[model samples]
Target: MKIAVCGKGGVGKTFFAGSLAGEFVLAGHPVIAIDADSSPNLALTLGLSAEQAKAIVPVAENEELVRLKTGTNYSGVFRLSFTVDDIISRYAVPTPSGASLLVMGTVKAMGSGCACPAHSVVRALMRHLVVERDEVVILDMEAGIEHLGRGTAEHVEILLVVTDANLKSLETAANICRLAQESGIRTIGLVSNRIADDRQEAAVRLFAEQHNLNVIAQLPFDPLVADAGMTGEPLDRSASSAIKAIGELAKKLRGLA
Candidate 1:
């Protein structure tokens, strides 16, 4: 299954995406976690050390790789199509959770139809992963779906929009859901994260109902999970409330598949 996790920034989209990738690995499936954020941090979330994360480069920022795939001699022209299969084999970094991580830095001005060589390469790679790859692919997308073209968005099987109880977060979630629907995605699930109490959960639920979003899961705020982020430690899969909630959501997604 190809799943995209997107929402407003700082809404815990990376946490959910990384946890779901680990859960898929535990279920005996090969998982590929893609970090499409401009400021990529999924590497740390998937258990990579700070130094290791710093050492690895993002695909869009890799001048050599992008030029190799899309560079052309003609002025201001580039190859529109190329094979990205070799990219996966050579660039995907293996994580401790048995899942591979791919950091795909954002293409600047892509939403404005920038046809630069780097943008072409990144766009092609995104399409290749969602439409061609057999393994389960989970993308921690940018703050909005504007980064995804219709071709890429339609191929994704599920889109999980995450939010907290904050009014701004819920507003962003509602906009993302509308964009996903317009992009031809049929199954859009709402995930509420970091709910501190019953009142917060109720607010999220009410917002979802008002916007016609399907609330699939609610993950309580776990202090241990937050501490791990600060200390650069991996989350405790066995004991984390957020991890358990994600595990159940993974099962529900597999069942739907």
Candidate 2:
């Protein structure tokens, strides 16, 4: 299963993605976690040490390596087609949750129709991950669907739209789901996060119903969730409300798969 976790900024999408990766790994599936955010914190969310996260250089930022994979160093001639099958094997860092992670930094714009060597490499790697790979892949994406190439949108099994109970967050979720639907993505699941009360949960459900969304799960606003990384804890039912919610959502996704 290929899932993309997206929502408004500060919506806790990274937490959701990382938690899902853990659940998948627990279920004995090798997960490839792609942190496609410009500012990636998924590594830490996956409980990687400070040193491990710091040591990882994003594929988009590795200029010399990108040049080797694509014909970008020596000649002006650019190749749109490049093989990145070995990229994950060579570059992915192992997370404590047993998932392999690949950080894809921001792709800068050169010019209209110009071949962006870095962006090309990132896209190629993503294409291979989404279309060719057999294992479950989860992408912690930005609110905008720029990272989800239109050609690979349908290939993704699920586009998880995470949102808080606030109206602004709901508005962003609506817009993202609309754009994804337009892009030929079929399954867009709405995940309500940080619900403070019954009223907030109701609001999120009503908003989803209004937008014709499939509300997959609702995660309560547990203070423990914010403190998950501050202290280490084993993964089990003894976890926090948010973590339990995340685990349930992961199970729901697997059942659907």
Candidate 3:
């Protein structure tokens, strides 16, 4: 059960990703949550201390760049210094509930080019980790699905693009779906976050139907979520409507009522 959650910035992709992973852990599945979003907030949302998260090395930072002669194969030329286990060990932090987290850090303000070794390394490691790892993987991607170019979408079983009620967010969701299609990602769906009431719910449903996208879940605008973030606490799954809906969505994805 591998899943990738993406959305427009500020639409709650990381929160949904973290909550989904936590719910799976609660349900007794060993899960590996990948923070593929360059913004990097899954750890905080999951209530992990900065020290614990920082101990996990970023994949790109840990990669070794090799300069290959003009004609060398790209894959053969670049070398990864760390073993998969080592990379996992250095980057995955286990929660008390048993879910692990790996942070895929941002490319250093440098544009996307082979010259950016860190980005290249991170991209390569992400491909390997997602495809080879045993545990159920959940990737929390940035708004644009940039990870698609790095082959992260290849291993994903479902790509959930989250959006809010606004027009801009809806447009972004459409764009993400288009990009995912271009990148060969399949099984795309939508999650409408911060839904206010029945009116907003209808709007999202209509939007999804019009766009021919599935609305797997609609999360209510909850102050508790913001409170949890502000206080550096994990969302209380039992009490949060949004979290509960996300959990149910996860179960639906897994076919595990």
Top TM-score model: 1
Q: Judged by lDDT relative to the true structure, which candidate is superior, 2 or 3?
A: 2
> In model 3, which runs have C-alpha deviations exceeding 4 angstroms?
54-57, 62-85, 107-111, 150-152
User: In candidate 1, how many Å is residue 131 off?
Assistant: 0.5
Collision pairs in model 2: none
lDDT of 1 by residue, 73-128 (tens): 88877888888989999999999878999998885534696887777777888889
Choose the strongest candidate by lDDT.
Answer: 1
Model 1 spans with C-alpha error above 4 angstroms = 108-111
Task: Give the alpha carbon lDDT tens digit for every residue of 1-257 in model 3.
Answer: 77888888888888888888888888878888888777687886676777776666665555432132112366445444433445567557776546788777774322455545466556656766677777788888877776545456656667889999888898889888887777677678889999988888888888888887778777899888888778877667688888878878877887831
The ten-residue window of minimal lDDT in model 3 covers: 63-72
Positional deviation of residue 15's Cα in model 3 after best superposition, in angstroms: 0.9
Report the lDDT tens digits of candidate 2 across residue range 1-257: 99999999888899889988988899899999999998998998787876788889999999887888777445676778878998988899988889999999974432335467788898888888999999999999888675667577778888999999889999999999988888777678899998899899899989888889889888888777666545644334355888787878888888878
Clashing pairs in 1: none
Please give the lDDT score for candidate 1.
0.88
lDDT of each: 0.88, 0.84, 0.74
TM-score of each: 0.96, 0.92, 0.84
Better of 1 and 2 by TM-score: 1
